[model samples]
Target: MQKFILTAMLLTALMLAGCNDNGTGPKKENQPGEILWVEVPDSIQIPPPGKFHKALVKASVQDPDGLSDVDSVYFYSRKPDGSLANKGLPL
Candidate 1:
C-alpha cells in the first residue's frame, strides 16, 4: 500500500508539472476569433439575362475575448475558376 501511494503521488506531480508552462511561448492575447458556422443557400434560381439575384448569408463567430471584441466580418465569393469574385464584402 505504501509503494502504491508513492507511485500515484509521483505520477500526479509529473502530470501537473507537464501542464505548467514556463512562459517561453508567445502570448495569444487579443487574437482574432474564428468562424464557427456559416449558413448559405444550396441552390438558387438563375436570373434572366442581364438581371441578378442576391443570396442571404449568415455566420456564427467566436472570440477568446468576447463577441464585442470582433470588429467586422466579411464574405468572399469564388468564381467557377476559383478566383475571388471581388474584394471581400462586409457582412
Candidate 2:
C-alpha cells in the first residue's frame, strides 16, 4: 500500500513538472548558453611574473531570439597556477 501511494505521488509530480512560468528560458533570455572567447598576447617586452597577458577576451555572447548578438567583451588573463590568492596582475 505504501509503495502504491508513493508511485501515484511520483506520477502526479512528473505530470505537473511540465508547467513552467519562466517564459521558457533564463531571465536574460538566450537561445543557448553564452560563449567566452579568449586570446593572449604572443610577444611582450615586459611580461608580468604571475600573469599571462591577454590580447582579447570576448565574454557572454548571447542569442536572444535565435539571432547572434554581442553582449559583453572583456580582456584579461588566466592564471596557470590556479591560485586565485591574487586576482590582479594586469592584462
Candidate 3:
C-alpha cells in the first residue's frame, strides 16, 4: 500500500512538471497585430526653385500584447544612392 501511494505521487509530480509554463512555447515574435495608416498622402510635391517644404505625417499604431512592446516606428527618405537619408529619426 505504501509503494502504491509513492508511485501515484511520483506520477502526479511528473504530470505537473510537464505542464509547466516556462514561456518557451510557440509564440509569434515581432508580429503586427494591427496596422493603420491614418494620413498616408497620395503625393508629396517638392517645392520649385530654392524653397523649403514640410509635410505632415501621421499614423495610428497598436499591438495585441501592448504598446510597450513596440520599440519604435521608422520614417526616412530614401536617397537616389540607395541609402537612407535620415537614419534613426524618431516618429
Candidate 4:
C-alpha cells in the first residue's frame, strides 16, 4: 500500500509539472478580407439532410503582429438560417 501511494503521488506530480498552455494555441496573423478556416458538418441533419458551407471569418484587418477582435470562430450552422454564424470569443 505504501509503495502504491508513493507511485500514485509521483505520477500526479509529474502530470501537474507537465502543464499545457491554453493561450489561444497556434498563433493567427490577421489578413485583409481573408477567410482563415472554413468547416462544414459533412451533412446537416435537418429533417433529412442538406449541404452547407461555413466560413470561419477572421474579424480583423491585416496585422502580422496579431488580432484582438475575434468576432467569431464559427460562422454558419443549423437554425441560424442562410446568414453566417459567428461564435468567436473576443480577446
Q: Which candidate is the best by TM-score?
A: 1
Residues 35-81 of candidate 4 have per-residue lDDT tens digits of 54544444534453565544333443343444554454534443345
**Error at 82, model 3, angstroms:** 12
Ordering by lDDT: 1, 3, 2, 4
Prediction RMSDs, each to the true structure: 10.4, 13.2, 7.1, 14.4
True-vs-predicted CA distance for residue 51, candidate 3, Å: 4.4
Choose 2 or 3, whichever is better by lDDT.
Answer: 3
Write one digit per residue (lDDT tens) for candidate 2, span 11-91: 988877866743665575445535555444543555688877544433444455643454544444445575432376443
Task: Residues 1-91, candidate 1: write the lDDT tens digits.
Answer: 9999999999988987897575676776687799989999866677999998998888888898998887776676765677666554533
Candidate with better lDDT, 3 vs 4: 3
Model 3 lDDT on a 0 to 1 scale: 0.72
- Candidate 1: C-alpha RMSD after superposition: 10.4
Candidate 4: regions farther than 4 A off: 21-33, 36-91
What is the TM-score (0 to 1) of candidate 3? Answer: 0.41
User: After superposition on all CA atoms, how large is the RMSD of candidate 2?
Assistant: 13.2
Q: Where is the poorest 10-residue window by lDDT in model 2? A: 53-62
User: Candidate 1's error at 33, in angstroms?
Assistant: 0.2
Q: 3 or 4: which has the higher TM-score?
A: 3
lDDT of 3 by residue, 48-88 (tens): 89995687878788897788888767666655677665563
What's model 4's TM-score? 0.26
Q: Quote model 1's TM-score.
A: 0.53
The models' CA-based lDDT, in order, is 0.79, 0.56, 0.72, 0.52
